[model samples]
Target: MTLDEDDRQRRLPAGRKAQLAAYVAETGQVTVSALAERFGVSIDTIRRDLDQLSADGVLVRTYGGAVSQSTLSRVDRAVDVRLKMEEREKEKIAVLAASLVEDGSIVMINGGTTTLAVARNLRNHRDLTVVTNSLLVPPALSPSAVRDVYVFGGAVRTLTLATIGPVSFRASGGSELDISCDLALIGVGAVSTAAGYTTSNLAEAAMMREMISRAARVAILADSSKFGRRLFAQVSELGGADYLVTDSTPPPDLLEALAENEVELITPDTREGAPEADQDPQ
Candidate 1:
């Protein structure tokens, strides 16, 4: 079993409840009986735990069990840990997002596993100028002969492996602050129609605000699972971004919200003979 599975199977009652929340976050929803069986607890006990979690707004109570809440709790994972979670989806998202970049254009990428995948895919575009605060991103584009990679300076966040703090604003001054990038790629921790875009880390959120203001256009790169969730820190509202590139078709409500906010939803075609850069949802 994976470590998370193991954690779910053999945790103490209190720890088990916490694990349950994470599981719901991963799967979106779960039934009471399934949660009880997985956690080796009585149905009554599971119900009580769910009630507590729901009251705390960590989950939403349903008929038989619960689903994840729209807002994510203040939980974080390491960069290496997240890099292992959505490898295939991230890569596909990277390919489609990279196609948005043209030659001889400046691009700003924030720090996140999904954005890191974007950097990797853009390595062949030697003529693109890349600016980022992610330590992991600069090296990814090092091999490209036509690329110019700039790593912003600040206090490095060990967990995310990105730089943040007051120094980040200083390092990205002058021309860098002129909102000159052709594209700004961001990663969303939680996003919804009501809550808009959010991240778990406040420092990262602050830095992302600056990146958004200085970019010519903003595009959010997130997987389907990240939808309908809100994190502790608000990056911007729905209208903050110009595009959302993803692998899945968002729900109808979210699609309407995006349209109302004037944000284009970009879903790559998973079929044969589709143009790569701007294919509609399949």
Candidate 2:
């Protein structure tokens, strides 16, 4: 009644084997329908593949699919884990932020997971100059056919992999950017009607505030989690932002506050094709 070696090997499921191979080829992220169609299996079978891969630490299970361990490894997981937790929502905000950028325009981007999404979506754009303090941004735009990137110099903050401190702020302040940027896409640790955008570190908050001051259009890219939360230092009052790009819907109170501040609220699907509104004619 003993099973032979070949019999034992045969017990290993074909579906699992195919999923592993697909994951290896695609570097772990694949749509469930694509995997199912590729293997002529059910959607449930692909889901099982994703579960096993996640258990093995070979990939991270995302909302619709799985992303490779290597892709997740690029950023420190402490930050990335929190980011990946809301992939679709962030990307939605990113898409809206990207639309704000014009070709051949100069822009300053802040450091955060949501800002990283904006960098990714900007790949197809051309002749754009980007000034950023985030270490993660340059690599995102590096493979693009067009794009000029400048990474601001300063003391590196390990937690977020962003450059902070006086040097970074000074460099940003000294630059005579064209139009001082068409927009500055920023990410905040927290946002409240009373406190505006805030961050945990005082120095970092100062740098962000300086960037906001210098930009022509100030767009804050925040998700629902940022709303209503307060942090250590204030970047600016909500009045500073010209627009706030977020996911589909935000909390009612926060929405009311944003409207009161006269901040333009943008969502990905609704605003993707919309033109940039006229900036305050101050």
> Which candidate should be chosen as best, given lDDT against the real structure?
1
Candidate 2 yields a Cα-based lDDT of 0.74
lDDT of each: 0.79, 0.74
Model 1 clash pairs are 126-146, 126-147, 179-214
TM-score of each candidate structure, all chains considered together:
0.67, 0.66
**Which candidate has the highest TM-score of all?**
1
lDDT of 2 by residue, 102-183 (tens): 8888888988889988888886578888988899988877354246677777889877889985423233667744435677
Residue 24 CA error for candidate 2 (Å)? 27
RMSD of 2: 9.7
Candidate 1 Cα lDDT to native:
0.79
Stretches of candidate 2 exceeding 4 Å from the true structure: 1-77, 142-147, 167-179, 272-282
